[model samples]
Target: MTDDQPEEWFRNSSSTAWGFLSAGAAIAIIVIDAATGWHPETTAGGVLFALVAYAAFFRTKVGVSEGDFVLHHLYSTVRFPMAALESVSVGRTLGAYAGGRTFVSGAVGRPLREAVKGAKREHKPLSNHADFVEDRLNGLAQDARDRRGIKRDSDEQFALAEDVRRSWDWPLIGATLVVAVVFAVLLVL
Candidate 1:
């Protein structure tokens, strides 16, 4: 049996673009804060945080390749045979606030789910990262079914994925832009 080692895949263009934009925005914020010279320390921290966050997001690995195709998100790193992959598809309508920062909310799988649930239990509303990761994985499985010419339970999964992708992106972008704009406006004011 051949080893199914993962090859590094290039980051998505859109993801990279967003990363730069966010980094630029963060830098801008820091600069503006510095120019005003009121709260230099706070402004510097904000800039550093944004830049670091941006680096963590797009500069980091978005997907990993194994043999035929690439698996996206951190979950792609999970130990599983290629056979375990059900499908590979881009996640659903992403919420904007999370989009420029990430594809899925957290590292994929059960640990993420537990963290999300834990946050919710603690009254900290969490993003739908795990669900999105699951959706993408299901899509991959569905694609596999299609490719193998196998009639499996992927039909519903595909349909759901379609819905998620369509509904998620715009709102996510909109929300992020809205927040960013609000911050800009506040700064201006």
Candidate 2:
């Protein structure tokens, strides 16, 4: 773990177990589809989708920890010398369009606010993926702050960190979605 370089975090044993289970499910899907010998293309698409889901759930990197900080899905790793961290801010709306449908559309504001609304509508507890990632980042941020006993994240800094966490995740999610959509299209055709 060098100061500036983030050490990639691999999936743990539980993740490995889940990966195996998911692989089994994928195999089962293929077997059933082959036995039926109908809609092979669609079945193949399902298999590919399952494979992608498996990779995402089991293979995606969790966090990258460097000397200064650790970057989770949305958050950046800690501050290191020469690491020009511009700013961190929290965002409400993370807009995206795919298949002519919007996912996670929110009014302009805070992610927490949107999350709360979602929870209420869905009748479930708040599921803030960004906040979950932020918790991990906060751990690292607090550690760095403690080491120096100097407060770095002012209101602006905190917001910037929140924003970094929110914005950084879109590209990764978008890439995954693109891959999945392409695979689906190829299979359908």
Candidate 3:
């Protein structure tokens, strides 16, 4: 095993960019429809929901830390200890079964894959980014058994405010509340 461990995780830059752009586009469409004197209320509701969903998706990330694989979402984070890995699935997305659950990510970012603006995507090296990431992930998982002195993430660190009944997920919940208030005002107006 090498002395160096990965300190950062890979992410899909293109998809991240597109998600934000789509959110902006939704807002624009809503404004345009409102000016047209159409039923903007219904459209506002749908777009607002989409905005919240996109925010959650935007916050998703997968990565490997010393002695563990981390899958992080908007309000929850699960760490599957390397020692508990059952198998690694490689394809359009990467998945793993550990800690009694299956975790998968389709947006494993391949920076080189989207590097050139108009380059053909079939290039050998760029196409293997998935393989590269997969191999790195698996390699660490395999090496985890023999590794020591590696600090695992504390339970507090993983303590994401996920309770929907409470105000834990403030950003998403706040958006929903704001939208509801707007809907109420619109109905009264």
Candidate 4:
């Protein structure tokens, strides 16, 4: 890393609220179970639920570094080289498409939308931070493409982006489901 190297940009919008809430809920459940003589299984299930919530919602980081788009989730990370990136699409969240992979940012953009709605309800205008992030991500993607090469056709890029968007996070989803099922079983028995 040097001054000439592009600075990394990172976003983890759910850390403050989601992280604290999940942690607090976990701790509270454990404490209450201990004091009230709840079954140990119930405590364990509550803790596991808290862990799942923290992992899925709180422990996420999305960024661009070293000419790669990075998505950091609870137990995995996916990276896509900027050279391979076709474009970025942002809606309720941010996504970078490259090499048939989509790197999605955690929870973002929603706060900006809520702020905008609040302002509108109060008859005031609101500054949108999501737009700034979208612009920055788009600029980085373009810069990456330019640095890599400019020979790619628009149709090819579009196809690749679509493929990336459609790709699913099967591992994480599966693990979460397993945890939920186990927790349910523990509660029932």
Candidate 5:
């Protein structure tokens, strides 16, 4: 693939599962409320629950493309060039830091121990998706450094321009915030 092409793009499957489960629960609540008594309060609660489900499921994407690591969320898109990356680490989740900003993968947790056990059982090495992605990103970062003739140094820091700004979806953020405030107020009153 060309430099501009994405190596891969993936959302957190676990988070997607949770989103679907929550949405299903919300629908169940609404159906139960309607069938039993059609209580307005119950209906409102169901709607709020559904909104939370939407927010969780529909808002996050992570990818590597064009020599940059990109993170997309409900309100913003953050990008960091590979050369500027200090490190990429995965624990319960994945994270990369560059230019003094940290970009976290939106996906759910991935346990390293579980992956290692599975790999051993399957007689494979580093066969899990998370490990594969981590390796690819690390390789890309190394390539970027090589291209720039940068050597690994403990004392020197790689920093990008301070003015680098993430693209934001203001309208979506505003709407979500408004809905959240309304939901909170409803609960309070």
Candidate 6:
């Protein structure tokens, strides 16, 4: 809250919850199709693959921790000094610019949330989930310009910096790998 304190906060993507729900849906569809014998093996396989690919969108995120802007991209978790950040923008999805104007998908919006919540009232927005998340991320980015060069007690800042710079979202990556192995076994069997 103060200029002297480090910025720390996070916003979760709806994709995370929806991705998990989608995985379950994909499995159920496959099982039901397997029983009905309605689709060919190739057709089922192709569809499942597409569904799984879409589920990878779950990893996206945008946050600020220890005066650093963190982005959880599909391939990596990147953290940079908030001072280097240029701006956060919203369109169909959330986006940001940092370090000489390189754009990144800082966050993503999910319409699937509407399907889970059911139809909204006549006055309510259909894309409320996406809109809410985009607004929060942009709001944080707007106020975080002062966090660029926060100094902490000796060694702590170094450790935090290293941890942020080197860390990956290992837990998600591990779970994904485990599920892939299980699915492979199921397919082979």
Go through the candidates in order and give the C-alpha RMSD of each one to the true structure. Answer: 15.1, 10.1, 8.5, 5.6, 4.4, 9.0
Which candidate gets the maximum lDDT versus the true structure?
5
TM-score of each prediction:
0.38, 0.41, 0.58, 0.65, 0.71, 0.50
Which residue pairs clash in candidate 2? 68-78, 69-78, 74-165, 75-165, 88-159, 88-160, 88-161, 89-159, 89-160, 89-163
Count steric clashes of candidate 2: 10
> For residues 135-155, could you state the per-residue lDDT of candidate 5 as single tens digits?
667677777666666664322
Candidate 2 regions with alpha-carbon error over 4 angstroms: 1-16, 35-38, 67-139, 147-149, 152-189
Q: Mind giving the per-residue lDDT tens digits that candidate 2 earns over 1-189?
A: 234343534233444566677778877777787788856555656666565555545544333455433222221222231122322222453322112222232211244555466535332213644444334444544554445344553443344333222234454556556656776777667
Q: Could you tell me how far off, in angstroms, the CA of residue 104 lies in candidate 1 after the best superposition? A: 5.9
Residues 74-124 of candidate 6: C-alpha lDDT, one tens digit per residue: 656777655445556444455666543445563553444443453352223
Better-scoring candidate (TM-score), 2 or 6:
6
**Candidate 5, poorest ten consecutive residues by summed lDDT:** 154-163
The runs of at least 3 residues in candidate 4 whose Cα sits more than 4 Å from the true structure, single-residue gaps closed, are 1-9, 12-15, 73-76, 99-106, 111-127, 151-182
Each candidate structure's count of clashing pairs = 15, 10, 2, 0, 0, 0
Please name the candidate that would achieve the greatest TM-score relative to the true structure: 5
**What's the lDDT of the predicted structure labeled candidate 6?**
0.54
If both were scored by TM-score, which would come out higher, candidate 4 or candidate 6? Answer: 4
Q: What's model 5's lDDT at 154?
A: 23
- lDDT value for candidate 5? 0.66
lDDT of 2 at 121: 38
* Cα distance off (Å), candidate 1, residue 158: 20
**Number of clashes found in candidate 1:** 15
Report lDDT per candidate. 0.42, 0.43, 0.57, 0.61, 0.66, 0.54
Ranking by lDDT: 5, 4, 3, 6, 2, 1
The segments of candidate 6 whose C-alpha lies over 4 angstroms from its true place after superposition are 1-17, 23-59, 101-103, 110-142, 146-166
lDDT of 4 by residue, 1-189 (tens): 111227565554555577788878888988898899877676767767776776767656666766556676666766655445666655566666665555676544445555456435332113544556666666776776565544444654544344222235566667667767777887788
